[model samples]
Target: MRFVETRWDGYGFFLDPSAYLAELPRLRGVLPPGAWAFVSEPGHYDIPRADRCVKDLELAGIHPATDKSGRLVLEFAPNRFKHESGLRISYTGVRHLSIDYEHSIDWMAVDTVLLDEILPDEDGGCVHEIALTDARITVRCRDLEAVWGGGC
Candidate 1:
């Protein structure tokens, strides 16, 4: 799929999915959990399809806490290898959510991060793929916003 560059006010540029995938190998050992698996596998990666797979694996359902009108936020803090600021992703009108953390909260440290938006489904809800250090967060919502320079 072809991805175009879009600008977000508080956030910087969005990475071109194709370009990011190509650069993955060179950035090995520093990739976030989901991305590590993508790079390790052969053949092309399908973002939307992967999102579906994750949702299926978790048997995801709309949480009672989910506000079809509420927002879901996820933050990734920079680690020693990456000196840049942190990242925060917010999804609006969240309809579905899932999180998998491979590390304890106290030891959390983010490395290379990747985010991809899935095609809208019949219900008009969208899904985002968040590949983070030792964690994988997936959400289906109506809108998404991302910002840098968070985490202390």
Candidate 2:
């Protein structure tokens, strides 16, 4: 599975559902417990759906809780990661996670460090502009359009 890390700007990221499902075991090993991992099917951004995603994650052994905003967050002790601003900050924790992207499109984001392995090239591939904020790190698949354009 491909990965990318960028500053949060209130917008989320994307992930390949197939890739994520295959990497669950490996992800479980690397991700710290209690980290908040938000999951959602593209174009279906609703609280109930998000809650359902949390339940799905639980079935896979990755337990997460929904925050007031309906975001599915993995329960864990607070931890810090280096931001583009060069300041360290505390976040929910896990760096990457899997979501059940039942839709034709797939994606997921995590609240963790922006690792070099997922950073896009200087010329720009999938990595968008970096913003220093409390937003979750968005990981998008390079092969698909991460946004919807309003259609059937």
Candidate 3:
């Protein structure tokens, strides 16, 4: 439900649990729903869906750090990810546009991680986001690109 600023149009935020929800409505105006064609009562689906791809990849669920913090972040791995859990979408005739991933990492593998210097200048932390457009698609990933910090 939270949003982070990023370098994409219309969509760009690390960890958009509802990104798919928005995408379905946006695309519905342009094309027919996917689920309706294959099966009846196609309650949910989405083409070029973001939520389906980013639901989980195991980002600490919480970073517990901020820009003011100066302490190093602890390294830890996630037990599961959204991809493994499966994403739910809304649509009838949905077709995959493309799922491009910039990075896929487990920053927890490295100790002494810092946020201010480690995370991206915008929307940094262990958070990541996926972007989908009618003409182009992008997935903003950074496995080891960012670091988290905890105030001492």
Candidate 4:
């Protein structure tokens, strides 16, 4: 799917890890164990979806952005999981992945580096920018939307 690194101002959605918020129901934690993130645009290389080279990234940490425009950057922790075609697309730009979208376990892609392959050029920030845009992200951890506030 897609990694939605958004940019917002004046009372953004995710800031504090609060359970009362409309988003982050899971307090304290950054994201869930399994999250599906990516974009609709193809990668820069000829990386097929059924390649064994794909490496899934984890939402490791969340912190402020170095850019003046961007206020934060959520680090994809570090892990890898394989994926297949059983995912259910709930809506546009959204996918429900029962399996973690970490790597091309079932040879889903040429290389799991697909997320890094496609991204809007940016120095990194916390303004609610589409970190991973136009792609379908499977986020099992609801906290992702709360911590990052991803949208289609």
Q: Give the number of the best model, judged by lDDT.
A: 1
Off by over 4 Å in 3: 1-24, 29-53, 58-106, 109-152
Candidate 4 steric clashes:
51
Please give, for residues 6-90, the per-residue lDDT of candidate 1 as tens digits: 2323433243466645655654544333334433344224433432111112111222334445766665554334334444455
TM-score, prediction 1 = 0.44
TM for every model, in the order presented, reads 0.44, 0.23, 0.21, 0.20
Local error of candidate 1 at residue 65 (angstroms) = 7.0
Candidate 1 wrong stretches, greater than 4 Å = 1-69, 100-117, 132-135
Q: What is the C-alpha lDDT of each candidate?
A: 0.44, 0.25, 0.24, 0.25
If the candidates were sorted by their TM-score against the true structure, best first, what order would they fall in? 1, 2, 3, 4
On a 0 to 100 scale, what is the lDDT of residue 110 in model 3?
Answer: 21
For model 4, residues 21-52, the per-residue Cα lDDT tens digits are 22323312332222223221122112234322
Per-residue lDDT tens digits for candidate 3, residues 81-110, read: 312232222211111223344332333342
How far residue 99's Cα lies from its native spot in candidate 1, in Å, is 2.1
- By TM-score, the better pick of 2 and 4 is 2
Worst 10 residues of 3 by lDDT: 112-121
RMSD list, candidates in order: 14.7, 17.4, 17.7, 17.9
The Cα error of candidate 3 at residue 117, in Å, is: 28
Per-candidate clash tally? 0, 4, 15, 51
Worst 10 residues of 1 by lDDT: 52-61
Query: For candidate 4, what is the lDDT?
Result: 0.25
